[model samples]
Target: MAHHQHHNFEVDGVDDDEVPRNKCRTCLKQNTLTIATVVGVIMGAILGIILKSTKDKWSEREIMYIGYLGEVFLRMLKALILPLIISSLVSAIASLDLSLSRKIAFRAIAYYLTTTFAAVVLGIIMVVAIRPGVGHTEMATKQSEDTRNVTTVDTLLDLVRNMFPPNVMEACIFQTRTDLTSPSPNVTDVYKYNISFETVQNTNILGLVVVAAALGIAIAQLGEEARTMANFFHNLMSVSMKITSWVIFLSPVGIFFLVAAQVLQMDDIGSVMSRLGFYFGTVCLGLAVQGFIVLPLLYVALTRKNPFTFISNMGEAIATAFGTASSSATLPLTIRCLEDKNGVDRRVARFALPIGSTINMDGTALYEAVAAIFIAQVNNVPLDIGTLIAISITATAASIGAAGIPQAGVVTMVMVLETVGLPAKEVGLILAVDWLLDRFRTAINVMGDAFGAGIVYHRSLKELGLLEQSSEEEKFQVDKNNHIDETAQ
Candidate 1:
């Protein structure tokens, strides 16, 4: 029989079984940032409400001043995005075998598509059941003459064109988008318009991801020759992460001004709520179902882990997403939370999260589906079964093309309306509340990305272990051959 030995030590005259004060202090210290963020949200909301009760209305310039801190925070986060995506993706993929990388990519894309389709279906069911727009009366609003002539074919082409940027440097600041230009006044056919591909002032994230993946694959193939290059990106990723950590510390303060400024900028909240309250409620309910119920069940079923615990680990990132109202801006925090707090692997987190943020828009898909159907109902247009199916398909496709910025979903919402013969100008009706809804959907988008990373990491564990083992075996063989050659000589 073997006996086990036990040793006990007391610190500062405390007994072994007694809880130490330092432990409690350390736990609080660790969670201080999260606590501050919650406080900021509550304080900001209260301050905004109090200010709204005053007689004076806030001007645009005044609103800008109020949100100045938030502006700085957003700029800081956006500035880091380009480097973070490139460095993280390149470094992570370069370390893996080509076959393993392929497996991981396939798994991620499958998960993204599945979740997005589910969100679309859920939104459609909620809108159909709730019937929020059944009794709404159309208001008289001026329609802008500058209607964008967007078609499904043109949109799909633009997606492909942006994926393969002609100039890598230009892609950093501009992405290619097709626009329909009206013919000259003297032209006989007024309906015929020229289709011109123009550059838009937005970061071409999709193109960057594709380029980075190719570069990483080339490096992996080069083996020892690309070791120095791989090291550079690895170090670059580390430095970017460090800077992101520092910026994240400012979130509580930034979020405070952001929420306050958003509240101040609204006009006649009572009137808008009276008219659109049901629509707002419907959207919120769908988002809640997708975020709380659908995503958790998927996570639990796939990983067999406590989804709530995983979500709790990602609280900071979700809160930041709500404050910023832009998933692109929230990418840095999402990556950090997945890797540092959620125990997801660096390789999986880096490789999958950027791609997910760019493409996996579960909340956006749901919102668009609901908004489209709501518009149809408001116009008294009866949508047949075929039309409903069209809405579902279009909403899902449009969301994939939507940018991860604030109000980007509205841009894609135009396509959904046009597909189902709804007036595009009806979008104005929802603009008043879109700002608030954007924040909620963006939070859900970030959550979906985080969940995808966790699932990918879990699924890829076997391949990752095998790759590591093979590398070790290869190294041993090389050493053994060298020893034999030296002795023979």
Candidate 2:
């Protein structure tokens, strides 16, 4: 069998040195997280422990002030989540060739659903096997008064209804707060509660995604008439990215206070650590299975390519995702790695990843399922097969709205909890470790995106009659052909 070399369309030189240095630096930078992030996390953990060990040195009022300021930084990150998803997705869609884009979109969605569903099932299995939340009764007892439950039937109905927003502005900017007790929720209570995506904040991200995608499709249909709209979204994406950069500069300071406050609030750091440690171990295990075992195997089976080579090629993108904890922010690097390093079609990467950043969140889906069930287990809420099935569905659906930014997993996990009669406030239980686990999930999410690009590019090649069959399959065919020719002769 002849081994054929794939050409990198993005780079003409065909030389090692011609490879981009920025991406090369990605691999080198792996051991070093963003300097500020490392400093902040380290200092925050130390300060939190010190404050915990000696309360006389730090006042609760001072901690509260620090936490309040830190929250402002979190809110800034949340504010960018929606704009980034919408603008990037809309711009990517509008800029694509509709016929090719539709094919790639279908494949991407199918692949995403398959992987996300698998991730959820894996999470459920892990939670059941490990039973990490079984003994954490205290955490469950602290459930907020706002905990609400809907029937399994209503849960499905609400998910579908919420996906299509009646008012896009309200959906993106303001979320509806439902008071389960009242037939008509009290007007004052509704007016008083303004939850964005964090801390009971409800920005209907799924609805926003639907609206953005629909607008993108509409703009694409307009052909030349849509130029201005397409350009507007492109520009908006640029502006949102710039804002994200400025916000990221403050992450170290914000993370320090956020971690310290969460730590200080825990009455028993030892107990908290034990429970969170189990949960963390479960999440990391799920991520490893999905990112390492499942996705790579899938790529090998689909493309007849060496999975190790694929990973090696995607190292820079993976590192970038880990360091930034933002798949959307890592888009430029992911695209370059796929095109220049892995020989993935530029069109496939362009179409698959922008949407994947918002929707194809295998890691987030798995985490949500694990978190929801973990919370339920701690609360002693028994989940039957029906309920677990509902959780799997709800987690997959809710994850469609997951923003490709750090800590967004915690926000979207609320949807899964609400579907299962758990309080959204339970999210605070895992908030302390979310920052750390976020890097893991973000890296997995970017891995999924890169895998999607590779698989889709291979499929496109086969469709165009360009891709070769595996060596064994080709050899068998050739042997059969030779036998047939000999008999005829």
Which candidate achieves the best lDDT against the true structure?
Answer: 1
lDDT of each: 0.87, 0.73
Cα RMSD of all models vs. native, in order, equals: 4.0, 10.9
List pairs with backbone clashes in candidate 2: 195-201, 195-202, 196-201
Cα lDDT of model 1 by residue, 1-489, tens digit: 122222223242355345576678876876677778878877877888888888578888988998899789878988888999899889989988888889999999999999999999999999999999988866543373335877666777788888899999998999898887777866633237787888989888889988998999999999899999999999999899899989989999998998988899888788989888999999999999999999999999989999998988888888888888889888888888898788998899999998898899999999999999988888888988899898898888888888888888988888888778866787887888889999899999999999999998998999988987898999999999999999999
Candidate 2 runs further than 4 Å off:
1-43, 54-60, 64-76, 133-140, 176-179, 182-201, 242-262, 275-280, 303-351, 371-387, 401-489
Name the weakest run of 10 consecutive residues (lDDT summed) in model 2: 190-199
Instruction: Give the CA lDDT, 0 to 100, for residue 484 in model 2.
Output: 100
TM-score against native, each model: 0.91, 0.68
- Candidate 2 to truth, TM: 0.68
Superposed Cα deviation of residue 62, candidate 2 (Å): 2.3
- The CA root-mean-square deviation of candidate 1, after full C-alpha superposition on the true structure, stands at 4.0
What is the Å distance of residue 59 in model 2 from its true position?
4.3
Model 2 lDDT, full chain set:
0.73
